[model samples]
Every structure is written in C-alpha cells, then in structure tokens.
Target chain A: MDKEFFRETLSYKIITFLKDQIAEKVDLTVYIFKILVKVIKDILNLRVGMKHILNQAARFGVDSLPLALIIVGVSGMIIALQVTSEMVKQGAVDYIGTLISLVIVREIAPIMGSFAIISMVGSSMAAEIATMKVTEQVDAISVSGVDPVTYLITPRVVAGFFIMPSVIVVATFVGLFGGYFPVHNIADIGLSSYLDSVWLGLYEKDIWVELLKAAVFGTLISLVCASIGYKARGGAIDVGVATTNAVVYSFIVIVITDFLISYAFFY
Target chain B: MIKFEHVSKKYDDKVVLNDLSFTVDAGETLAIVGFSGTGKSTALKIISGLVEPDLGSVHLDSRNMSMVFQYSALFDSLNIYENVAFAFHERDDLKNKYTESQIMQIVSEKLRLVGLQNIEDLMPSELSGGMQKRVSFARAIVTNPKIILYDEPTAGLDPVSSTVIEDYIIRLKEELKAASIVVTHQMSTIKRTADRVIMLYEGKIVWQGTPAELLEAKDPYAHQFVYAKREGPMKTTAEAR
Candidate 1:
C-alpha cells in the first residue's frame, strides 16, 4: 500500500510537469499564430495601413543591405577559395563552379542572410518591443482600443517579409561575384569559364527555393522577436533576456527551416 | 462613469486586489490613496482595461479612455510630435477628419496645453522626467478622452513639476469635463484635485470620504497613511520583516 501510494504521487508529479510544459508551449504558439494572422490580414488590406508597412520595409530591408552584401561576399569568397584548392588537388577543378553554386545558393546565402537579419533586425525588434512592454507603452496602446498586434506587429512582419528576400538576393549576387574573384585570380580559371559553370550548375528550382527559404526565415525571425519581446515582463533585465531569446530562437528556427527546405527541394 | 464591481486580481499566490468595488462619476475626480503595493495603480489599470480583474468586471460608460502611466510610457523611438500624434493617428476615423497639417496643429495645441511647445521635434529620451510626464499628459489629453486615468502622476516629480501636473489635472477636468481617477502618494494633490478620496489597505477600501474626512478619520490605518505617521495599524517593511 505504501509503495503504491508513492508510485501514484510520483506519476502525478511527472504528468503535471509534462502537462504544464506542453500547455506553456501551446500558449506561446497560439499567441504567435494570432500575430501572424493579423500580419497577413494587414498585408491583404494593405491600403488601410500602407504608410507603416512601407516605412518598416524601408527600415528593415534597405538599411541592412550593406551588411548583408559584405557578409555574404566574404562568406562566398572563403568557400570558393577552399573548394578550388581541394578540387585542384583532385584534378577536378572544372567542377568548382558546380560545388560553389550549389553550396552558396542551396545553403550558404539564405542561412547567412538570415543570420544577419537575426543578429541585427531581430535583436532590435526584441529590444524595442520589450522596452515597450516594460514601460507600459504596450498597455497604453491597448487602452486606446488599438490592438498592438495590428498596430505594432503587422507592419514589422510585413517589412521583414519583403526585406529578407531583398537581402538574400543581394547576398546571392554578392556571393556569386565573390566566388568569381577567387576562382579567376587564384584558381587560374577564366571569368567566363567560372561564369559558364555557375550558369550551368544553377537551376530555376534552386533559385525559387532560396527565395522561399529567405521569406520563411524572415517571417520566423520577426514573429519570434516580436512575440518574445511583447511578452517580456519585469524591467531592463527582462528586455535583455528577451533580446537574447529572440536571437537564439530565430537562429534555431532558421536552421530548422533551412534543413526542411533543403530536404524538401533537394531531396 | 467608470465602475469596478467585485473585482479581484492576484499575481501568482499573492492577491493584489480582493473583491474591490468603486465608481467615479462623469466629470468628477476620484483619488485612490494607499501605501505602495496596495493596488492603487492596479485599480486604475482595471478601470482603463489595461488589466482585467481576475474576478468581476469593469464597466465604462464610454469606451474612450487614456492613461498617464507612472513612468510616462512614451514611445521612445518617436519624437514628441509623433508620440502625441499616435493617439490621433491610431484612430482611422479620427484621422479622416483632419489633414496632416490639421493633425500637426492639434498636436501642437495639445503640447501647448501641457506647457510644452516647439519641443515636438525632440525625442522622449531628450526630455527630463517632468517633461516626459507632461508629454505623456499631452498624449493622453490630445484625443480628449472621456475617461482619464493617472497612475502615480506625481510619484517621481519635483515639487514644481508636481504642482504643474496637479494644476493641469484641475484645468483638464474643467475643460474636457472628463471623469478622472488619480492614484497618488502626495497629500497636497488629493486636497487639490480629488472631489472624493478612497484609502486602500491590502486591496480593500478601509476608509473613504472627502480629503477633510481623511484627515479627521478615526481609522488607524487611514490616520497612519494620511498623516504619514510611523506608528499605527500599518507596519513598516523593516518591522514586518
């Protein structure tokens, strides 16, 4: 009887813990989904709040272009140099463009582009929203009969959605150009030959996949950042925690998304 | 009129407000006074719909309301003009009645009412604590909301600034004819602004009457609170610890 009672009590505790954990995650997911729906609705009704979305898009997409270009450019050059050196040793240098193009487009560009967005834009969104929450600005807005989801989250998500792809496109082109430089200068391959192999290796489907991945990753980053920040409580320390959480969650989501997209498209 | 009936709120295991009820008539200023953590600010938040009571309901005769937060809660990214304008721009129907220049005119006018003008181009961070409070006041009154909630308006202000805010509350009551609920620690503000006062103790109204009655009240808790006495029914944090 004693053993049965102890086992029953232990099982109850374990079940309660698991239930609470699932409930918390479900609650968070539901909140995020609600914000996502509101954002999509605002996009469909673009004429209603066009000004905010345009301003956010300009801020999120245009401002980050320079950084995106530089990071992708450096990343592509490094990969190209390494790939060319390895291929040269194997006397398979002709296939260097195939390796670089596939790796950059299918993997590197979207992931790096998102990393830039997560580090820069995602952290900013989290800090701004968390500060708003801490200072009662979020409550103040809500009291005005304006839903924060519509007024705050929508414009940001829309802006991020448009900007992520633009950054990725910039990253892709910068990366391709970056690969061309190392191959032409160091690998003793002509620009035209590298260009020809890149052109031959590239597929219409791969380009679509890169664009799709960028858009998805952008949405995930913005959604996670805004949600985490909006839910942040307490003081300045909470805002810091929210910002860190936003970046960490965004990276996790982006990597998981990248894997899913690559497997779905490539496999 | 704004009314909270049988309201209760708790944060985890600690109860903030328990079975609280109150009402503020239209065009009347009601002061909520208490020791810190007695849920005075929470009561105002309940009335403003910033927080929903765990039990009971808050009924507002009009949906239009504005709250002046304790920390001012100004949008840090926006300049003074934009912060005040946010109140107007948030309502599409309101925005339809005014052109960009007209909206700017309204924002300028509201700023002037709070004794702030030409500082519209400046950010909230550029302003002093008093100026931020005044800016938030401008934002609150810009729309001329039917109900106004001031949470610790004078809590952190200097004497001169507190006087300014107190005087503005009186002026706004006259001009807008709006119902106001003010939560404060300053005795002078209660005498100056409130038509009636309610003293909260442990989320319950222990004594309630006009400012005059608050002074003469026999309730030990009320006496200790109003006179800022060290000895009475209320225990200091150190003593309690």
Candidate 2:
C-alpha cells in the first residue's frame, strides 16, 4: 500500500458507500408518513385512549426527575445569582423569571436535556449493535426471521425522540424554582411580580414551539446515534470510537438544527 | 435431504465453488473432506443460507435445516439455554410453534443430550472450545430439524473432545433420526462419523464414496487425502491445480 494507493482506496470506499446509500434512499415523503404512524402506534402501545400523552409524560418522568435535582439544581442557583446581580442595579430584577423563561424554554432546556440523554443512551445503543456485529448476532437476527430495523431501532428512536420534549418541560419547571431561591428574599424581587412573569410566558404558541424544538432535537439525537450503532464496525476499540462519534455528532446536530429551526421560527 | 445443484460461488472473481453439485439423503451422514480454501466452509455456508450461491440453488426439497458452524456461532450474550433456543428466535413460525417455556425446556433437554446438563445459564465465553461445539450442536438439534450441517465439528478439539463430538454426532443421528452433512479435513473424523465421504478438489467433488470405498480408492487424490500425505493430489493442487 503506497500512500497514494491507500488514499485512492479509502476514497473509493467512501464514494462507493455514499453512492449505494443515495441509490437506496427511502422515499422522504413516505419516511415522514412512516415516522408519524410509528409515533401514533407508540402512543397507543403506551396506553390506549388516555387524554394525556403517556409517551410524553412517561418520558418526562423517566428523563427529568433526577436531572432536575443535579444538573439543573446547580445551573438554577448560578442563573439566579447572575440575573439578580445584573438586573438589581436597573431594579428590574423582578423580571428575572421572564428572562430565564426565554433562555430556558427557547434554548437551554432543549439542548441540555437531550444532550445528556444522547451521551447516556446513544453510546449504549452503539456498544450494543457493535458487539452484535462483532459476534454475528445481527446476522443471526436476519437469518432467524426478524428484521433488525423493527426489533432494535424502532423502540429506542421512538422513546428517545419523544422523551426530550418531556425532559425539557421538566427542566423549565425546575429552572423556574431554581431562580426563586436567591431572588425571593435576597435580591428583593417581589414574589407577586415573579409569579406574573412566569405565568405570562405560558402562551399556547410558546409551548407548542418549544415542543417542536424538543421533538426535532430528540429525533436527530436518536437517529444519528441509532444509525451509528446499527452500522458499528471493528471490535472493542470500535465501540469506544463509535460512542465518542455518536456524542459529538448528536451534539453538533442538535446545536446546528436548533439554530436553523430557531432562525426559521422568527424569520 | 439437501442438494447442491451446479452451485458456484465467487468473491471478487476468485471462484470458491465451481459448478459443484451433490445430494444428501435422509438418515445418512455425508462428510465432505477437503483441505482449507478448497471451499469446504463456503459449501457449508451455501447450504446454511448464510451465503447465497451465485450460479446455483441449494435445493432443500422444502426440508427444514440447521447448521453448527466451524467456529462457535453461539451468541456470546445469550446463556447456554438461549443460545440453544436460537432457532426459535429466527422465525415467526418457530414463535408460533413453540412457547418460550417450551423453547427453553427443549433447549435444556438438547443441552443434556449433548452431556451439558445443569449449565444452561453458562455464557459462551465460559465454555471451552469443545463445550462450545457441543452447545452449537444443541442449537442445531433443539429445533428437531430434519437436516443438520456441521462445518468442521472436530477441527480444533483435543482427542477426547473430538471423540465426544463424534459420539454426539452419531447419537444425534441415531436418536433424532436426522440427516447430517459434516464438512472437515480430518480423516479420522471422516472415518469415525462419515458413512459416505466426498473429497473436494479445486472447488469440485473429485471423489465421493463410503469410508470402505475411500480405503479401497485408487484415485491419487483420495489416497493422498485419506493418508494425509503431502506427496500427492492436495500437494499438486496447492502448487498448480
């Protein structure tokens, strides 16, 4: 293998893979329809005929409870301190609830909640499929009569996709209380005005928009991570490589897509 | 009964099986004896449906089949019971045919049949090579498949393990009344297990007969192969065939 030959071969493989994928591209219109159907089916599977969304609520319960205590707890204290110090001079610290709502609901909740899950779930999925690939378990699945797509990918993607919005909702609630500690008595922000600021941010459009963002972020994380896991190669070392790649890629996609979607929201 | 009809397989233009055809009848063990790279495993893969034939069909006459691969094909994650119950996991038909408890019970019975009782929860990594081979056998028989394909069952085992494997193969045929196709390079294994021997050379069946016929063979390839001689057909084929 001369350097030039190696370079050509590697490029050839990459090009070939891309070409194959392009040729085999599933219908985008059909894929969206399929995903909607899957989401509906998932909802039905969780519990039938419940007015409240079990998928979303269960996701919130599973994802946000502990996250609320730890990551958001610290962030909440820092946010309260930062906002109170800045706004007290202007004597507008009463509006800390409003500002925090804007940042948490619009950005931080969506990013932080989903990003953490991606690190936890994405790597595990990758390690799982990678081991199956290394040991021929996936091949066994195929030979035996089950499609790997339905058995392995569907539940995780569905669970992960819906879970983020729920988690973000929990994060937003946690952050609101987090802002309360330093401000209620220390910063001289009145409780009545703070409640008003929090309640006013609860517009129907804002809630829906936040939800759309959470869903997009969740889907992207699960899709990228599951895709990486399903196609994982090499051995034990490869699992680690895949895990790192999945986390990095999921975070990057979340940030970029979030920015793009946010820009579209206003533009 | 399994039959390979004019089967040819190739990878990157190097022909592995070239117009190879053979038949396996009911209740008989056909041992395919050949050196490595002579396409023995490739042939086994074709029959097992793990690898598709490029130029032919592996006609099963609709007979159900299973395989114990040369290497331990047991799932590392699955315990001994689940590993043996693998055939059930493959098909929706198997799902309908056997309940989970029934599948597990059958797996335990098959494990014991292979002399691996009380170890159904052991992982594949815990087992030695020969034990793994026995578990693979358990997997093949768990379904009561009519045709079982063993790809080099005794390749890396010590003499004791090898003999155990051979006896288990015999017991499986006698007790389960299933046809078996054993592919190996071990002449002793062929003598011990094969009722009929097929010698493959350059991706084709050059010789096939009973072990008695193999002993009486005048064909240089058969003679050289049976005696493990480095002086004849296999040697010449490796050099220039």
Instruction: Please name the candidate that would achieve the greatest TM-score relative to the true structure.
Output: 1
**Candidate 1 DockQ, CA atoms:** 0.70
TM-score for predicted model 1 compared with the true structure? 0.93
lDDT tens per residue, model 1, A1-267: 999999999999999999996796678778788877777776687623778878888778866677778888899999998888888889987889888998889888999888887888889989999999998999988877677877888778777777788889889989988998888777799988888888888999989998899888877888889998998999999999989978887887789888988888788
Colliding pairs, model 2: A144-B90
lDDT of residue B59 for candidate 1: 87
- Give lDDT: candidate 2, residue A75: 70
Considering just the first chain, candidate 2 attains a TM-score of 0.74
Chain A TM-score for each of the predictions: 0.87, 0.74
* Model 2 lDDT tens row, A159-226: 65667777767777777777777777667667678768767755676678789988877667666666
In terms of lDDT, the poorest run of 10 residues in model 2 chain A is A47-56
* lDDT per residue (tens digit) for residues B5-80 in model 2: 9999888878879999988877889999877678888888777676788898887754467777767667786788
- Candidate 1 chain B has its poorest 10 consecutive residues by lDDT at B232-241
Off by over 4 Å in 1: A1-27, A44-48, B236-241
Two-chain DockQ for each candidate model: 0.70, 0.31
